[model samples]
Target: MSDKNDSATVLPEVTFSTFVLSLASSALVHLGEVPNPETGNTSRNEALARNAIDVLTMLDDKTRNGLTPEESKLMRDVLYELRMKFVARS
Candidate 1:
């Protein structure tokens, strides 16, 4: 049996939202909207940012009718925010 007080040992559960958020954050970095964690500088790369956004769009299409309502909304919101940011930064 596991102990009740194991919060320190337990890791956060991975979910679709977390995955999408990770990609979105990376895309923002590529678009120079966020700084590169390693370099402490923002490097604008539209190609990479667009690619990431495309990947997310593909995921949205492929996962249609498969995600919960909340999950679907989160994915849409993230994509919208990323796209808008990409456009503004371009």
Candidate 2:
């Protein structure tokens, strides 16, 4: 007999490679708005732009140490795009 309160617990190993892969995947989905089909429409485009900004902000904070020079340049480019979109909306 097992206690009802006892629950099975599972934990996956965390590694640098896994972390980087997860970050990259998340960044892609947010930047591309993969799950939101109306992302490019005028009504939803602001939301998509905001999402991209948020993702870039998070990546800049989390992966500062892990990013290569090329990755940093790409991040900067994305940031610039986000800024331009924000300004355009104003």
Candidate 3:
């Protein structure tokens, strides 16, 4: 049936690596638009870091391909540092 064929035509599941990469790319692009409270300037770096944290939080062990435990820990640390900086600046 046409419906069956359409279902079969759907794209395959996305790998974790691909998903992460896509999320990272999108976050980087949006980072420039995030507003800074103090100077009223855009803080792209901070935004990117925050986005990364959000993405990581959504990732699970099965969805964290290509990232080792060390890398995950590093990302968390970086996110924490950025959040602190943002709070301090504000």
Q: Which candidate is the best by lDDT?
A: 1
- lDDT per residue as tens, model 2, 1-90: 556666575445675444544444444444443444445422334565566567667877889888888777666666676566566564
Better of 1 and 2 by TM-score: 1
Ranking by TM-score: 1, 2, 3
All candidates: TM-score = 0.83, 0.48, 0.34
As a TM-score, model 3 comes out at: 0.34
Which stretch of 10 consecutive residues in model 2 shows the poorest summed lDDT? 35-44
For every candidate structure, what is the RMSD over all alpha carbons to the true structure, in angstroms?
A: 4.4, 8.1, 9.0
lDDT ranking from best candidate downward: 1, 2, 3
Evaluate model 3: give its lDDT.
Answer: 0.55
Candidate 1 at residue 8, lDDT?
68
lDDT accuracy of residue 45 in candidate 3: 65
Residue 43 in candidate 2 has what lDDT? 39
> Which regions in candidate 1 have their CA more than 4 angstroms from the true location?
1-12
